[model samples]
Target chain A: MKSAAIAPGDVTRYGLGLAAPLALVFAVFFIAPLAQLFYLSLHNDAVATVWGLGQYVKFLTDPFSLSVLGATLLLGAEVTLLCLVLGYPIAWLHQRAGHWLQTVIILIVLLPLLTSVVVRTFAWIVILGRQGIINSTLQSLGLISTPLRMLYTQGGLVVALAQVQMPLMVLPLITAIGRIDTNLADASASLGAGHWRTFFRVILPLSMPGIIAGCTLTYAAAITAFITQSLVGGGQMLFMPMYLYQQASTLQNWPFAAAISIIFLVAVLAIVALFSTLGRRARINGDAT
Target chain B: MMIDRRRLLTSALTLGAMHAFPGLSYADARPLVFATFTGSWEEAHKAVLVPAFRKASGDAPVVLDPMLSVDQIAKVNAAKSNPPIDVMLHDPGPALVAIGQDLVEPFPVENSAYYKDLIPEAQDPNGPAPFFQVVGLTYNPDTVKTPPTSWADLWNPDYKGRVGITNLNSTLGTGWLVEVARMHGGSEANVDAGFKALEALKPNLAAVAANPGALATLYQQGQIDISPGNFNAIQILKARGVPVEFVAPKEGAIAFKTTIHIVKNSPNKELAFKLIEAALSPEVQTTLTEPPYLIVPTNAKVAMTGEIAKVLAKDTDELKKKFVFQDWKTINQQRASWIEKFNRDIKI
Candidate 1:
C-alpha cells in the first residue's frame, strides 16, 4: 500500500520534470506572445497609444462585424456537417471492408493530406471554374447551355472546404469505429432490431467520442483556414480570418485585429466546449443503459 | 583537450542560443538588408539593381529581403531602434503610411545625383520614386475583338458576366476606385458615386478577386475576359501565352509611384543610400525597363524603348500626359472605410 501511493506521486513528479522543457518553451514562445497580443488589444487607437476596451467595443457593437462572425461560424458548421455525413459511411465501409480493400480506402482518405492545402484549393478552383471539367462535360451532354457559376459561390466554398477538411473528420472516426466490438452489431441485429436500429443503438452512440473529436477538429480548421477560405471564397466573402488579415496587415490596425482574434478564439472554444458537453451527456446516457 | 559530456552539452547549447538569437553573435555591422517587393520586382532587382549597387559601393555585401510593403513596415516598426531592413520599397499608399508612422528617414535629395533627373511626380523628399506601376484594362484579345479603350468599357452590356474586379484591399484596387470616383464627379474624400458605378457594374461582374494577383488567374481560367489589371503583371501573363492584352484606358492609366526609402536608424545607412542611388540611376532603370521585367521607369533620363515605349510612352513628356497620378495622401485617409463599405456592399 505504501509503495503504491509513493509510486503514483513519484511518477507524476518525474513526468512533470520530463515535460518541464516543453512547458518552458510554450511559456516563452506561445504564452508570452499571447499575453502581449491581449495587452495590445486593450488600446483604443490604431497606433495603440491610448488604452481602453475600444477595439472590442468596435467589433461587438458593429452589426457588420457580428454578421461576418456569424457567417464564419455558419460556414464551419456547414463544413463539419458535410464532413460528418460523408465521412461516417466511409468509416463504416472501412470497418467492414476486406484487408486489401481497407488499404485502398485508407489511401483514398489519406491521399489529400499528403498534398499541400494550396495545391488542393487550386485544384478545386480548376474543377469549379467556367469552361472547367464540369461545365464542358455538361455542355457536351446537352445538360445545360451556359456554364454554371460555381467557383466563388457560397456552395462552392462549402464543398471545397468540406473536401479539404474531410480527412480530419474521417481519420478520427476510423479509429473510433475500429475500436467497437464486431459481435455487438450482430447481437444488436439478432435482438429483433433492424440494420438502422442497430446502427443507431449500437454503433453511433458508441462512436460519440470520435464524432465529438472529429467535429472539434473540422470546425476549428474550417474556420481558421485562411488560404483555402480566401482562395475558394473569393474577396467578397468576409470570414473571420480574412477580416483579421485586412485589419492587421492592410489597415495596420493591430489593436482591432488582436481584439478580433481574441473574440474568435473564445467563440471557437465555446463551440468545442459545447461539443464535449454533448459527448459527456451521451456517454452518461450510454452508461445508464 | 578531452571532450566530456557536460562540456559538449554546454557548447551545443551556446551554439543553439547564438543561432536562435543572432544578435548575440553579430551585434552590429550586418550586411545591408534591402526589402524589395516580391515576385518579378525581386527578380528584377536581384538581376539589375544589386549589381549596380555593388559596383557603386565597391562590391559591398548586400542582402535582398523580398516582402510586401506592409510587411516591411511592420518589421521595421517592431525594431525601430535597430531596424532589420536598411532599405524599403513601397507603393504610393504604403509610402504615405510609412512616412506617417515616422519609420522612414527623409531622402537626402541635395546629395543625390539623379534626384532632379526623375519626373516631378517621382520627386518626393520623404522618399523618391524610382519606378512607376501603371494600372489599366487587361483583356482576352481572342474574345474581346476590339480592345477595351476606356474604364467604361468594363460595363458594356455585350460583356455581361465577363468583367472581373478586385476589392479595395490592394493598392491597385484602391487606386482604381479613386479614379472611378473621380470619373463619376467624386474625389478622394467621397466615393459615393464610385459605389453607385459599381452597383451598375453588377450585371457585368464575374468575379471580385482577392488581390491583383488572383485577377491574372481568373483570366487564365477564362473566368473573366477583362478586368482592371497591373501593367507588369499582365506582361508576365501574356509571356506565358495567356492571350491577354493591356491597353491604357482613355481616362489615362493610373500611375502608382513605387518609392524607395532608407529605414530610420538602419545600421548600413550609407550602403542603403547607395542602393537607393543605384535604383535611381538611369542605367539600372533602363535595364529594368527591358523585356521580361517591363518595369516602367520614373527617371526622366532613362529613354523609353521596347514594349514600354510602344504601349505606355515614348518619352517622359508623353508618359506624364498619359499617366493619372491620384493624391495618395487623400486616398490613404479614407481607404479603411472604403474597404469596409466594399466588404459590406460588393456581393454578386
Candidate 2:
C-alpha cells in the first residue's frame, strides 16, 4: 500500500477522482461568485456599471463607515471572548463526563441552533423587556422601583449573540480537547504541577488549534449577523452588515454595498489569519517543549 | 486516434453545468415570477386573486416569491439581464428607486382601460398605483385614555416612556418625518425642524422598530402605547384583537401609494403585465380592501363602504385635501444620509 508502489497514472486518477466534486463545487459556487462580487465592488454604478474603485474609496474615507467598521469589529471581538470564557468549561466537562451525560450536555448545547434565530431573539425580548419576568421579579422583591433598561442595549445584544454563538465555540473546543491525550494532564500532575498550572502549561497550549477554530467561527457569525442584531438591538445599535444591507437593498447602491461587503470580508479574514499564525506558533512551541 | 480522457471529462462537466439551468430551456409557458409581501398579504392573494387570475388567463403558471419590497429591488438590480422577479408590489419609496435605477419599466397607461378607472393620483408616471395607505397616528385605546388627535399630541409629557416610532427605512417613518417638518414650519426640503422635534420626543420613545412586524410585536407586548403607523397595520392588529385604533391626525394624514411595476427586461413580460392587470381588477381590489388585507384601493371603480370607507379617503379630491404624498424620488435620494443622522442624533 506504499505510494511509491503505485503507478503515476493511477495516482493522478485517484487524486482527480477524490478532488473532482469539491473542486467543481468550489469553482461554481465559491470562486465564480467571489470573482463577480469583487468585480461589482470595483464598479461605479448599479446599472451599466463601469469598472472603477470609487465605491471602495468612498467607503474608506467616510467617517460613518469607519465607525460602522469599528462597531462590527468590537461586537465580534467581545462576543468571541465571551464565548471562549463561557464555552471552555462546558467543552471540558463534555470531554470528561460519562457517555450518557456527554450526550445530554451535547444535545443541550445544540438546542438553540435547532430553533430559528428570529424565534430565539423574540424569546430573548420576552425575557429582557421592560415588564418581562426578570424586571417583574426584581420589582416584587423591592430591588428597584423602576424597570432597568435591558433590551436593545449593547450589553443585551452581546448577551444574546454570545448565547447563539456558544455552541459553535464549544463543539470545536470539545473536538480539540478530546484529541488531547488524558495522559499528558495526568503526567503534568504527577510531575508536581497544580491543576491550574497543568491546564495553562499543557492543556491550553495544545488546544490552540481548537481555540482558533472556535473563535474564528463565532466571531464571523456574530459580525455578519443581522436579524438578531436588528430585532434585539432595535435598529439603534448599527452594525456593518445592517449598513451594508441598507446600501445594497434599501438605497439600491449596489456598488457601495459590494464595496462594503468586500471590506468586511477582508477584515474577518485578517482576524482569522492573525489567530492562525498564533496557533501555528503555539503548535511549534508545544512540539519543542 | 487516442481519446484524451481529461479533455473528454472536461467537456462532459461543462455540458452538465449548462444542463443545470433548466429554467432557460423553455422559451414559452415558464411560470411568471411575481414578488410581493409575505404572511397574510400573500395568503389573501392566494385565497382570492391568484385563482381568479388563473381562471381568466387560461390557467397560466404563476410563481409567487414573497419578499420585502427592498429585497425585490435589490435582487432585480443584481440580476439586470434576467431578473428573478418579473413583477413586484412595492411602496412609492422603493418603486421610485426601482424606476431611477431602471430596474422597472414604465406602465403603458395611455392604452390600458384600467388606467382611466384609476384615481388621477394613482396614475403614476412610473407605474400603476394599485393601492394607497394612510400613515397616521396609531394608538391602543385601552392604554391611552385620551386618543391622540394631532401629531403634536405625541410630544405630550404624559406619553413619555410609552411611545414607539418606525425606523427611517419604512415609508411610515419618512411620512411621519415629512408631517413633523411641515407642522414645525419646515418642509421636507428642510427636515432640521423634524429632527429637533424627534430629539425632543426621544425621552418618551420606548423603541424604534425597524420593520412593520417588529412594530406590531412591540404593540402586542404593550411595550409602546403610541406610534405613527399605517392603516393596514392598524387594521391587522385590530382584527387580531389588539384593541388598536387608527386616527387620521387633525393636521392631516400622509398617503403612501403602493404600486406594482413590471421589472425591466423580464423574461415573462407579457405574463407580468397580465398579473398587474389582474391585481388592479375590481374583484382583486375588493378582496384586498376587505378584512385582513384592509388595503385602500386606487381603482376608482372599487368603492369603499362601512368602517373601511370611514377611515379611507373617498375620492381623489378628498385624498389630495386630507393626505399629503411626498416627493418620493427626493426622499429616496436623501434616505441614506437622513438615516445616518437620525441614528446618530436620536437617543432611541
Winning model by DockQ = 1
Model 1 docking category: medium
lDDT of 1 by residue, A196-256 (tens): 9988877998999899999999999999999888887898889999999999878889999
- Where is model 2 more than 4 Å wrong at Cα? A1-16, A45-50, A287-289, B1-27, B74-85, B264-271, B313-320
- lDDT (10s digit) by residue, model 2, range B102-144: 8888776775657778888788756788878778888989889
**Which pairs clash inside model 1?**
none
Interface RMSD of 1: 0.8
DockQ of 1: 0.63
Off by over 4 Å in 1: A1-15, B1-28
lDDT of 2 by residue, A1-289 (tens): 3566765767787899899999999999999998888888898876525889889888899887888899999999999999999999998998899999999989999999899888888888887787777878899999989877787788888999999888899999999998889999999999999999999889999888899999999999999889888888886677888888877766667778889999999998999899899889988898788
Cα TM-score per model: 0.94, 0.89
Report how far off residue B89 is in candidate 2 (Å). 2.1
Best by TM-score: 1
Task: Give the least accurate 10-residue stretch of model 2 chain B, judged by summed lDDT.
Answer: B21-30
RMSD of each: 5.5, 5.9
